[model samples]
Target: MRKKSVIAALILATSILIPTHVSAATPKAGIACSKAGLTRTTATKKFTCRKSGKKLIWDKGVALPQATIAVPSPTPSVPTTNADLIYVAKDQRILRHLTASDGCANPNAATAHLQVLIGQNWINVKNINFGWAVTFNVCPPEQLGKKDSLAWVEVYMDPGTTYRWVYTGEVNISNRNAQGNGISGSTTVPLPRPVIDPHPVEGGYGITWENIASRVQDISAAAYTDAQATIARNARAPTAADNFTTYLSPGAQSIDPNIQDSITLLKRTFTLYAAFPHPSKVFFVGTTLDEKDQTYAKIDTLSPGNPFIKNSFDNMYGINPNLPAGSVFTNSKCNGSDALRNTFTWPDLKAAGAILTSFCPTDNPQIHVEAHHGAAHEYAHLIQIQIYNYHNLRAAQPCWMTEGEAEWAQTAVSPDFSSYLSLQHLHPYYLTTLGTDYSVPTNTVWSASELTDYFANANKIATCGATPQYALAYSAGAAAVEALVAIGGSEAPFALDQRMANGESLDQAFNAVFHIDWAKAVLILSDVVAQKMTHVNQSDALTYQTRP
Candidate 1:
């Protein structure tokens, strides 16, 4: 007998007022319910309790549709106008309305149209129809006081195509001044060609080396022919004896017998590579000796007679004569016992020369191979520099080509040296480590796409240095040269150098020799390296032939 019971009784009275034809037992529509969230279903439809005004009642229900379907209406098309072509200044609000002074009041006024040259035809850009005078005011507010009327429009241009703004149309009475005078003319202003900066301030455009090569002016036919002739003249076969003279330092006579054997091996390596043209002389300076204090003294004693020693060592050590002779070996710049080679150009004497310095004692077999093959490696660099008549190999070519070719040269001279076997083993590890950020995995062989992306994004080796990245030039670089030789025959790498000496870029030389672009050659080289590293078995002696 509470208020809730009174409301329930009144709902039952309302149900009695329903028509007899409609089923009063089931929930039809507009029926009272006890509370919300209640559902009732019938044979034809389903119903849910919904709030109607302030009362909870069974409202309209959903019913399944018949088989008959209705078609949808077509969408309307929007017209493009001059407003769509107008350029909006950055950080400025869009101008919604144009006044009479904006120059649209004169419908027949002479206007300029922007057109771009496409296949010998000039096509209108964006249908931008507007008077040249009004362009100054419509573009930006600051253009009002400018002497010349100018405006900007957004349009994509195809490379190597020309574009211009054309002025046309007729003047009408509305465009005339109060004195009944009007200015009318038709002309065209050519837009300047766009310039592309190879080294942009903002990075990540992935511009290839070919992009930069294309901008350089090509060498003349006469110059190219002359370079080819020079290369052919220098392409002689190896001789039985050494063609260049060797000068041994005073300390070299007193070194261990094992070191002397390494020097003999270096001379044998030089004789093998003597087929290629090089400098006339080479000096052998042994930094290690029985007495350490005599190292700099021996170099100084040889300096006055030898121009290379005078210019390089005498100039460097003579600064402080009081410094101990052993200080030459202890200087942070000088390696402790590594073999090194340096090429010097004597401008005053009008000559060039090369020198090999061996500091290692070669106490063991591994050190002996290193000293022997290491000297061969440095001599190969001299050959490369002289072949191209270049001062530095890294300047004319990339570090990979420079160092890799040297590594290849050394192995070619001494196939049983075992240094290249270690390099072959290191190649895979270096590639995998360097390519980590680029999604190159270590467990599987790299695909062409993966290798391409890795090379594209990998840190470029620009110079020959001691860093791990620079070390890649020796291992992977040698593999790349092997691939090149396999593709273009034995002289392909040197042929590339010859062409580059004729003032052609690396991409141009690559195409001239291999009949392929540098990018494609790189893809093939990388794939070959990956395959050799992951699939092939390395041997102590490199069986790959350097010459046919």
Candidate 2:
């Protein structure tokens, strides 16, 4: 009886222990799990609790062939920081950063420096310093709205190493006063050959190996050249007058007895521009008649025998090696047109001349007026070229400004010649296709983008042939100038040119003279163009009859 009682007690203990061990729930696929990474083993399979599309659920069990041993995962490696990227933002601001997350967060103050290449040597940029502890640092703005080949950035990484980023491409800074945000051009990676423990020398940004004195000299020379140009510009007022002479070609007299009348008109045009700044000696030669069979012999006889004049005639009619490459005037004869030449002789004797052709007294009254108008236009170019030379300005002014100002100058000679009226008459027909149409009509409304593009491509248009597209510089360009005149007075164009000659860009000059931004000016001009287009009538078309 005692042995039977002990066996009953052992069976009861086993039943209580087995029920306690089986109390926990079994894991099944697609069922909610209490904890992630939890696993369980059954007789047939092993299941794991893992993330299944945002929910912690028991994963499908893996078949258990035998008892398995678990192994731990290897540790992940940390990523190193990438080299710094430097680029010019669309608005012409220079920016530097390590990565999207990592910026120029330097702990040291004023360690980030900006430098500019002034000839061949890099010199420290003056007046602006980068001291901010931010993701990216904005370098000092240089040559705003224009490409600058001479700018770069440097940052001190440590006492033993300094990272440098040099722009391999031209960088243009924003014309706006505010800093730019997005990159505009190619990004430059940090130099592979790091600057090692570079010592800051005078006038250089932590570049001990460079000849600091030579760099200083280059900067000084550049400043001196600018100063000289400024002095030359200031020496003559816009209203100052200069001397000029006129000569008529033999063909001019042979073609028409009333050629003297055209000569008189040419003199009048010269007199009109005499009040403005001009080259010291301007020689006006007229009438290379018979457009298809034109010859330089007649022009040679009529010219003042000045070597510069001869060279200009050669360059205009024949191929002169001295002529600038891609010059629009190269082998560009005045056979069927008029032109201003010898601008290359500026600031010396500064010999310049106007070659008038295709117009004679024998032509109809309207054609006669057009001929004189063309002469007046060429004379305006003489004044324009002299001003450019005085300042030693190298960049060609925007086509709109160049041609529009010339068109406006026609009225300066005679109110009978009105560019404003001519453009008004044509505006209605060409309003919808201003940029696309080859007529280059000035009467259409303008967008900010179109104006910007026109301004940007002014040089290219000036250098190309006189396609209808090139005429935009005349028509629309005249309208822009007329708008400028209406807002800023007649002296506005001259003042704008003067400002540009003094080293300010067109945008800068426009803002300074008009007290308005380019976009704002575009809006105002658009309204002006729209009003002219809207007011068009039969009488307005008649007004264009007087246009030269």
Best by TM-score: 2
lDDT per residue for candidate 2 within 41-132, as digits (tens), equals: 88889988888787877889999797677888887653222224322223222222221111222223112233332223334333222322
Residue pair clashes in candidate 1: none
Candidate 1's C-alpha runs over 4 A off are 1-256, 260-275, 289-307, 310-337, 348-350, 361-363, 389-392, 415-468, 535-548
The local lDDT score (0 to 100) that residue 335 gets in candidate 2 is 39
- TM-score for predicted model 2 compared with the true structure: 0.45
TM-score of each: 0.44, 0.45
* Tens digits of lDDT, candidate 1, 1-548: 69999999998877765532233358867877655767777766778877889977886887745555578878755322232333322312211110111222122444544554444344555531232322221222233232223322323333233445443333221344233433223122212222111111111222233341221111111112222232333345452123444445445544434456445655655554444556655555555433335655555554445546533443233332222233232232333355455555553222435555545443455654565566667766766776654432332455567777777656554433233344332343332211111222245444556555444433232212212344455656666665554344334576676555444556766777767787766766666555544433435224431211
Per-candidate alpha-carbon RMSD to the true structure: 32.4, 28.9
Q: What is the lDDT of residue 325 in candidate 1?
A: 32
Query: Which 10 successive residues of model 1 have the least lDDT summed?
Result: 93-102
Candidate 2, residue 522: lDDT: 59
lDDT of 2: 0.44
